[model samples]
Target: MPELPEVETARRGLEPHLTGRRVIEVRLRRSDLRWPIAHEVRELLPGQRIAAVDRRAKYLLLATAAGSALVHLGMSGALRFLDAGLKPAMHDHYDLLLEDGRLLRYSDPRRFGCLLWQGPGTLHPLLRRLGPEPLGPGFHGDHLWQLARGRTLAVKAFLMDQSIVVGVGNIYAAEALHAAGIDPRRSAGRVSRARYAMLAATVRDILSYAIERGGTTLRDFINPDGQPGYFEQELNVYGREGQPCRRCNARIQCVQLGGRSTFYCPRCQR
Candidate 1:
């Protein structure tokens, strides 16, 4: 699945071509992706002028006068900007034809992506209760400390909670925790404020760096231009189990935490 940085990269790649452009055509190649494509999307999308392209968490918001088109690029989804004449591939499932003759195509092999609508003043359920954006001001050390006060969940599990903070997925969570020198299995409520502060900073730094590098491409992730991300080359311990740690030279270890694979350096992290 595309994490926040990958999704943000897609948003950045699409904004220049999408903003201020009028949607001349909208085609839903199938009726559903993850869930049924909403009727409002087919009815109100065409002829609407794109006011802005924004991202909340991992979802891209295409703002228009009538409503906002909400897009979530699930596991294998890729959105590409192509010339109007380019032929659609086998997985190409939807297209938005712009007045400028550019076509924004959505392709998903797993069909887990989503296209939904949100009217003015109405928040979609998936987005309504999400915690603050990890890259935003609202997600500081104090915020994490407060939410973590009484939770017995492992730190890794707590950090992955969408209600505590959004977009710190499995990859970034492991990276950030390793960088902060906090063990993933530590009890969340027992973590100190000072350590939480360190964790918060590492989270921001890791995410910012990944976004700058266009996100980590493990599999099936590409920028809107079809370029694979280069950040994977710089990974510390996310997938280097049984290898020497770059910082401490200790054998990197892997475990299953919260049903997700977790990698860490025993000596370097806690």
Candidate 2:
């Protein structure tokens, strides 16, 4: 699945083309995606102008007067901007015909992505409990420290928790932990405040840089322009099991933590 940076990259690519444009049509080729398509999408979205494009965690929001359409580019999903006259491919799920002779297309081979509704003055259930954005001012060392008190979960798993801080997925978590000189298997409650501060800053820095690099291109992720991300080339520890560590010349190791593959350099990260 596309992480926060990937989703944010998509939002940045889609905003200019979508904002202030009227949705002349809402083309839903199917009745559902990961779930049933919301009725308001086909009923109320046809005539509204997209006011803005925003992201929360890994989801995208296309804002309009009637309501906001929430989009999740689940595994194998891609959104593209194309000429309105183009024909749809087999996996092309939906299209939003714009007034300017362009269309925003959604294609998801796995169908895990979703198109849902958020009425005015309301927050979607999915968005309600998510923690502050990792890049936002609200997330910092103190926040992590507070939530981590007495928690025995591995630090890497703690960082990947959406309710703790949104968008620090597996790849970035491993890289950030390695950058901060912290082992992925360290106990969340055992990590010191000072180390937590360093970890927090590293997470912010790594995520900001990753977004700038257009996000990591793992599996099916690609920017809205159909380009793969450049950040994957810069990875330090993630997916480098048995490879030499870039920092300490130690062998990179991998272990399962919270059911996900966790990677780290035994020497550099400790």
Candidate 3:
């Protein structure tokens, strides 16, 4: 699935082509994607000008007077800006025709993504209880320490909790914990406030840098312009199991945490 940086990269890439442009048409190639594409989306979207493109967690919000179009690019999904005359591919599921004669197309081979609507002033359930954006002001070290109180979950699992902080997915979580010198299996409640401060800073820095590099391209994720992210080339430990740690010369290790693969340097990340 596309995580925070990848989703943010998409938001940036789509902004110029979408903002201030009116949606001349809305087309859904199928009835559902992960869930049913919103029934009111087509009816509410056309003729509405896109005011902005925003991201909350991993979700992308397309602002319009009628409502915001909420998009989640699940595994293998890609959004591309194409010429109006461009032909749709087999996986192209949604299209927003723009007044500028361009089309914003959504293609998902696995159909796990979503296209939904949020009525004005009403927060969608998926977004209502989400924790502070990882890149936003509300996600400081103190905030994380507060949430960690008395939590026995593994620190990695705790960090993955959407209610504690949003958009620190498996890859970034591993990188952040490694950077902060924290073992993924440590209990959240046992982590000291000072260490939590370092962890929080590491998380923010890793995510911001990944977004700047166009996000990690481990799978099908790409920017809206269809460019693969280059950050994967800079990875330290996430996929380098058994390889030498960049900092300590110790071999990296891989373990399964919450059913996801986690990589860390045993000597460097303790």
Tens digits of per-residue lDDT for model 3 on 1-270? 778999999999999888899999998888578999998788889999999999998899999988999999988889998888788889999889999888999999998889988999999999988999888899988898998899998899999998889998888999999999999988998899999999999999999999999998997787889899988998898899999999899999999888889898899776
lDDT of model 2, residue 203: 95
Relative to the true structure, how large is the alpha-carbon lDDT of every model? 0.91, 0.92, 0.90
lDDT of 1 by residue, 92-155 (tens): 8899999999899999999999999999778999998899998998988889999999999999
Model 2 misses residue 20 by how many Å? 0.5
lDDT rank order? 2, 1, 3
* Model 2 residue 121 lDDT score: 92
**How many backbone clashes are present in model 3?**
0
Residue pairs in collision within model 1: none
- Candidate 3 clashing pairs, residues 3+ apart or interchain: none
Q: TM-score of the candidate numbered 1?
A: 0.97
Which wins on lDDT, candidate 2 or candidate 3?
Answer: 2
Point out the worst 10-residue segment of candidate 2 by lDDT. Answer: 218-227
Clash number for each model: 0, 0, 0
lDDT of 2: 0.92
Model 2 spans > 4 angstroms off: none
Error of 2 at 162 (Å): 0.7
